[model samples]
Target: MSAALRPFDVAAIRAEFPILQQQLEGKPLVYLDNAATTQKPMAVIQAITDYYSQCNANVHRGAHQLADEATRRFELSRDKVASFIQAYDRCEVIWTSGTTEAINIVANGIAQRLKPGDEVLVTEMEHHANLVTWQQACLRSGASLKIVPIHDNGALDTEAFAALLSANTRLVALPHVSNALGTVNPIQDLTRLAKAHGALVLIDGAQGIAHGGVNVREIGCDFYAFSGHKVFGPTGVGVLWGKAEVLQDWPVWQTGGEMIAQVTYHSATWGELPNRLEAGTPNIAGVIGLAAAIDWLTQFDVSAIQAHERALLAYATTLATDFEGIQLVGTAADKIGVFSFVLQGSHPADVGFLLDKQGIAIRTGSHCAQPLMQRLGLPGTARASFSVYNTLEEVDALFRALKKTQRMLA
Candidate 1:
């Protein structure tokens, strides 16, 4: 189906998340820490409950009715994920513990192929999940880890990225959206440039998938990785989508049951495409819940969700600009619902604590992008990230709490 935007019903949407009805510290809870992880909708929670209640069994191993049912549901989630990302083939989708493990799987496989002095490129805006794995891979192979700089405006320096790419560049790891800055990188353009230099590209879609759906074929990247928890799904479940041709030759990273074709005393043969990568007992219930989340999300037009989030971010940004001693950290022309900022003469942790007293939940500190923090020359920033269920009223409440926090600190 073609993607289109529809009018959003915020109240109805908010009702789907049960956690939103609660209170914190005797005040109504105002959740704005979505960039860390989104609250699960009832649909997702119920799916998990149903799995544990009705069909809890080890998948793909038994002939019992419950095992058959469990296996069926587990594989069904893979099909749903493949469709969600518009992957070329369903077999291209490999399940992992989350984005961190997903990236590690690729890095482990790529480690076998890297050579001394080979260049692995990454942007400065990457989260630790994407950056650390590549650093380890380069270190193991005696390869060089090259960095692409970000502009002062929180956008990637595309010109610097272009200049950095060369025949020696083996892989380019980047994020679809900056988790800390909320800057949306031009993935398609970046992928094309990397591919032109004969480098494979891996996009960390942990933030991007929640904002809107992704189409891997259109982006032209070799691999895409995302976490389920970031998109209103259960934690400990994520996807790694790769081109079949490329994955076919990649060496297996993990070993054990469900990933071997033949076992012997001395050596064993690995299974095909996805099975080769996914080893041992999987997160069956989490995968099922993730599918439910994706199913619920598809009921609404993704473009509509994106627009709503953008509106919330713009509203928050405007309000922050008017506040005294407030400095917005990332002001990229393109961004999502993440508002990272710092107040003069106040520590980020103190601000977070003060906000929490009023039942406002926001993230503080480096947000796992310490390298990006070092580049920006700040200890940390207080972050308020929005989602589809967030409202203008919540944004207003956030500012009110911030005002109170500023006064207390002053």
Candidate 2:
């Protein structure tokens, strides 16, 4: 690896993100809304543009030249995703509209096999995307949805999680990291506990994939889902990985043109693991853009990226904690460069609006983790999440903006 591949070259990395260079409200855009969606790089943008320009065709349905090119690119994107997560085979990778769709696919597929009186386990820290799908699935299947509560520090109670696992537990869906609190959970440990109880495991990796790279096989998880937008790709693409045998046993959730092997009024057969799950026409250009994003990420050492983000997290946390009346939510030993905090007597939305005038974009709300917010006894939190393209200067800018907000409110 080159020396520039080392962590903390914020200047060089920021240059690749053209949007960050532009002004918002007459100031440079200090993008800290990474938890919502990351800013795309030139490579990803170009990939999407080039695909639509040259390879626009329906995938897996035609024999024309454009279709062939589009199909090749689309399938190649699946391969790239499989490699990105170190899955056993590309067949294990299924593309969806985004993480919400991916989780819904798992919930629906597993719901088909569930019986009344069964249970599905989850935690209070889950994003609504992970929570509601299982909740609805259990309701439809006549199975119960069991939740493991969190401690005051916003960490999952592992012992409580263990207690929730039982012979009747059909599945355990949990987040690898909390989107609201940046709490990194012990996914492997949870998977082991669920497996020991003879239950399947699914991990929601939306925030986890943004901070650290994952290998689904290494995690020993039955299923893993994440969105491309969280990992610097386009918004429309996401991935769901399952064990080949597990997916092979799943009934098709949707039916349409490309996923069918053969069809009749009385009988229809679906394709293999991935195609069976991915019904209808796939998102060709978005998938191609995701592949390019993965390629761009692979060019630099991931270890260096993790290290850089950790350093930034430490600095940012220290700065934020120094301010009075600012309460930090999650205090996990392991966390991504995400911080959610609340200033005394100030609503998160107010803080967010004040910061926006300075061109510091952040997320302020329940962050789709309403259960977590309820557990913490707050309405919501102001969240500043970092990406590799963010710099120390941007972190300083955030502090300055927060101080200005504080002064104005006081």
Candidate 2 lDDT tens digits, 1-410:
57765444678778989899899999999999999999888999999998889989998878899989989999999999999999999999999988899898888888888889899999999899999899889888899999999888888999999988889999999999888988889998889889999999999998888775798887888999999999889999999888998899787879987688899999998887778888877888889998998887877777878888887788888896678889888878877778899989899999999999999999999999887788889999999998898888889999998999999988
lDDT of each: 0.93, 0.88
Candidate 2 Cα errors over 4 Å, as ranges: 1-8
Model 2's lDDT to the true fold? 0.88
Model 2 TM: 0.97
Error in Å for residue 49 of model 1? 0.8
lDDT string for model 1 (234-319, tens) is 99999999999999878897899999999999999999988999899999999999999998888788778889899999999889
Write down the TM-score of every candidate. 0.98, 0.97
